[model samples]
Target: MSLQHFMDTYALKLLQAIFVHLGYVVLCVAIGSAIALVLAVLLTRIPRFSKLIMPFLSILQTIPGIVFIGILYLYTGMRPITVMIALSVYAIFPVLKNAYSGILHVDEKYKEAAKGCGMSSWQTLFYVELPLATPSIFTGIRMTVIYLVSWTVLAAMIGQGGLGEFIYRGVGTNDNRLILMGAVPAAVMAIGLGALLDKLQKKLTPRGIRLQEQSESGQSSGKGGI
Candidate 1:
């Protein structure tokens, strides 16, 4: 197909690819972050468990994506859900590890202060630790999103349609234009989205901790203390 014709014909497919990949990445990050946060919290409460689990998570990260996906496909056998499971699994380690590290690094004095100020354990976490850890956790999540968008191309192997179809089509037919058409757009989308999310992280991240700290501080000053 002519470039213009391809653009016209495949515009929707491209959009679907963009959205599907976007959803895929976002889901992986969300699921990973949720699970990781839970695991990290559990580990924090049980230091001995952190030593056991962190190493296992680190080992999972060491396994190459191809090998991991291959193993999943062998056991789960090439399905859309399997593809998602694989990607989600691969994406979890970074967020989990970072969350654990971030939570651990929260200043002891701050925790003590939060307790001194009458914060409960959960309140201390929500009001202090988690807010401070947002940047680190989000950094790992951002990395996972970028990684998954590119990795989702592998989904085509299982008949999970996306931009990968175009590249596979090109490869099978030896059509250079088709390959370029697919590869270029996918790259542009990943890089562009990653940069945008990075900017968002910077903007949305709290200056120190507690997203509304500046406003809260202002309100406290205005009220002139208890």
Candidate 2:
């Protein structure tokens, strides 16, 4: 199809598909991040359990996206909630792992300092550990958002509606243009959202941590130049 013809034919539909695709991505990330954050915090308090639980979650993460969604659809029927549940579950692993790792790896001296100041466990977590962990947690969130954009395409398999509709339809009919209509937008959306998150990560991370990272990076580069 010619460029003008493709645009004229699909302009409105493409907008709608992008909107639907974006909606699923946002909802999955928000829901997954919240759940993961809570579980990560809890896991920190029970480090032993994480040894078992994290491995189990890692196993689940290895499951193919299509298989996961298919199983959920079979059990839940063809509903939007099915897509949400499947996507959110898939989204949880990265954030959960990163958040747990970040919080766990926080410097012991910081915790000691918080205790010296008479801060309680919860206060220390909120003011010290979580702040220090923000960059790592944000990295997981960025990963989740980008992955979710691509995963949301699977939602169309069960009629949940997204760019996948174009791609899947194109596949059925062997139409490359239709495939591009879905693919190019999804790629752009992923890049755009990832960039936005990069900015947000810098802002959310503690200034001291940022400066420390910059110093370390410079030192590494300087040594490499020797």
Compared with the true structure, all predictions reach lDDT values of 0.80, 0.94
Candidate 1 structure, TM-score to reference: 0.83
Q: Write the per-residue lDDT of candidate 1 for residues 1-226, one digit (tens) a residue.
A: 7878978987888778767766777777678778878988888768999888888888888888778778888888867777788888878887887888888898899999999999998898889888888878887777777777788788787777777878888899998877876788788877887898888887877865544667788898989964
lDDT of 2 by residue, 154-221 (tens): 99999989999999998999999999999999999999999999998878788999999999999999
Best by TM-score: 2
Would you give me the overall lDDT of model 2? 0.94
RMSD, one per candidate, in order: 6.3, 1.5
Q: With candidate 1 superimposed using the best TM-score fit, by how many Å does residue 203's alpha carbon deviate from the native?
A: 4.5
Best by lDDT: 2
Clashes of each: 0, 0
Off by over 4 Å in 2: 1-5, 224-226
